[model samples]
Target: MVRMAVHQSRGRTQIKDSRRGCPRYQPHKGKSLTFGIRPEHVTEKRVHTASSQVDFSADVQVVEPMGMDTMVFFSVKGTDICARSAPQAVVGAGHRMEFTVDLHHMHLIDPEKNRVIGHRSDDKAKTSD
Candidate 1:
């Protein structure tokens, strides 16, 4: 498992990943890699609480209400991030709201290679194939 310090608007949140032990990531361990998570994976409501789920709060910079879901815009460490949330759960811009990021769905990219190194779900799919 690897622990990453994510700098947020208010403070820093440590994200823990249980999949770091995967052999595929061993060589890249301790090297710089880009972290990514889909907007859908970052939600206002978490399906379950796991060690890989990180909770943090951010000020809403923009809110787009779609028919089925709402897209929320925020920033962390100067990087703009979007999160998909249930329309009813979305708060207006300028308001602080909490979000949970499911790291199990996160993707790690090798910066130099400019491609995805691996992710928890990807490893599972590859093994099954």
Candidate 2:
């Protein structure tokens, strides 16, 4: 897990989705939270159950081609996130690219304890009644 912090409202992002539909990042109230995202989990624009996704448009900061996929880098909430993209991703620097995060695969940690305390789950997105 990586240690990170954001403003009260920074955890959420909004995408003026070209597809008209967009994903949402459910807020975390944990005073301290750390999380890790894998490149493969970062994919081309996609939509899952509304509560299970986080979609955003990011600047294509860097693209490095690997044997089968390209390593993409961009910043979100001031943290650089890396992604494994198709080798054919011709996205170059300065262009905006949309990315999707599948909540089922994400891990969250309690920073002080340095152990994973939760996984980003769609089930948690339900507004408490």
Candidate 3:
């Protein structure tokens, strides 16, 4: 779902899933565009068994412990994204760490219309209704 151009400033874009190849986000009829990954899906472990994976290294900016999940803030691709970590993630501000993106959880969007391009069958079913 994440249709990105892999820049050098950040990292390369790896498309592992694409089992459905690439689908259109109706009314646009174009390729996948912007995408978003929820913090909850961001994990310290790179899920090699997952459908796809995206990796990057960023400097930790903040760490907010919230009982079960710790909120981590870091900058990547000139944007700051949060990640949900365990109670003891052994991460702290000013540290550079590599993070992995779970491809199955990517929320892609249509560039022209800034609309989410649903890639799941459930999405298609809901939209059809």
Candidate 4:
């Protein structure tokens, strides 16, 4: 697991399996990196009870209802983020709504290098004694 602070945000969010595959790019403590998660991963529904899942509230900026699903837009630490939700589960714009982000599906990118530095892994890490 890895903990990173979102830019302009007060606290750090924990991400699981962040450095599973990429061994060459070692992110130094306090170094800035990009956090990315698919819109589907950020949802109003809580599917997993894993430790990697985090719950937070954000003010909804816009709501686009697309028949079966809705696209919710909000801002986090000055960055605009979107969430895909069931059409019936979405609240109106300008309202505070709760969201669950599955950090296991998160991707960490090295902004300077424009490369993915870390991500979740489905397989166990191999250890050499």
Candidate 5:
């Protein structure tokens, strides 16, 4: 269990996510996103505890699922990416995975809203009159 400490001028407050514990992600397979290969440059890094460190690239795409509990997708490149079963899998900052495409030339889509962010270079252009 994780405990967060909140301090007030008068006193202190301790907040716990759970007293005993709670299950991780529930079992439900409804919708999932399929990511492709993309390139990105290494941007930042973070040190965890005193031993481990995470490296992050400038072009990595971090995706948070709609309503699910503990499901997140990290897109390193167009075709290369990793899925985390638990949130604790990805720790620190600066370093995530690796990508082959630049940060500016990346595309992402939110199917639920029918919204697309970014685009592929080879995609057909839409001309406006």
Candidate 6:
């Protein structure tokens, strides 16, 4: 669970999320910050085109370090989503914060899957046919 503070005009509000861990949001008069609980996300789909067909995957993750005091931005680059933060802090100590986003939307690829795809090397040798 993450605990954070939402800075208000008068003071700040402490917030908490079980899924994302401790996060604090500090708001300014004319600006605000957002943070993503998950560090990475991957979307897999089949891309169809008149010329050819190919597998397309959109991998996204919070570029900045994931911590209690960080802000997240929602923007896509060539269909890829990238989580970014403003100059201000998003997660902090005890401050009340709230969210209306579904944590499930932030999906990351399983590490085990990388091994099966030959991205990781194994010491064992293959058998002859």
Q: Which candidate number maximizes TM-score?
A: 1
Which 10-residue window of candidate 5 scores lowest in summed lDDT?
20-29
| Candidate no. 3 TM-score | 0.66
lDDT of 1 at 113: 82
- How high is each candidate's TM-score? 0.72, 0.64, 0.66, 0.70, 0.20, 0.19
The candidate with the higher TM-score, 2 or 4, is: 4
lDDT for model 6, please: 0.29
lDDT of 5 by residue, 1-129 (tens): 111122222232111221211111111112232223232221223233321123344333554433332233444334434333233343333344422222232223435544442343223354321
The total of clashing pairs for model 4 equals 0
lDDT of 5: 0.30
Tens digit per residue, CA lDDT, model 2, 1-129? 355432233445222222212123234342556767678988767656666677777998988888888888888768888887776654887888887776556655666666554333434654442
Regions more than 4 Å wrong, model 6: 1-92, 115-129
- Regions of model 1 farther than 4 Å from truth: 1-21, 47-49, 119-129
Ranking by lDDT: 1, 4, 3, 2, 5, 6
Instruction: Name the best candidate (by lDDT).
Output: 1
So what's the TM-score on candidate 4? 0.70
The sequence of per-residue lDDT tens digits that candidate 1 reaches over residues 22-114 is 445556656766778899999995656776777788999999998999999999767789999998888899999999988778776777787
**All models: lDDT?**
0.73, 0.63, 0.64, 0.69, 0.30, 0.29
Weakest lDDT window of 10 consecutive positions for candidate 6: 21-30
True-vs-predicted CA distance for residue 55, candidate 1, Å: 1.1
Winner by lDDT between candidate 4 and candidate 1: 1
RMSD of each: 7.0, 7.7, 6.3, 7.0, 17.9, 19.7
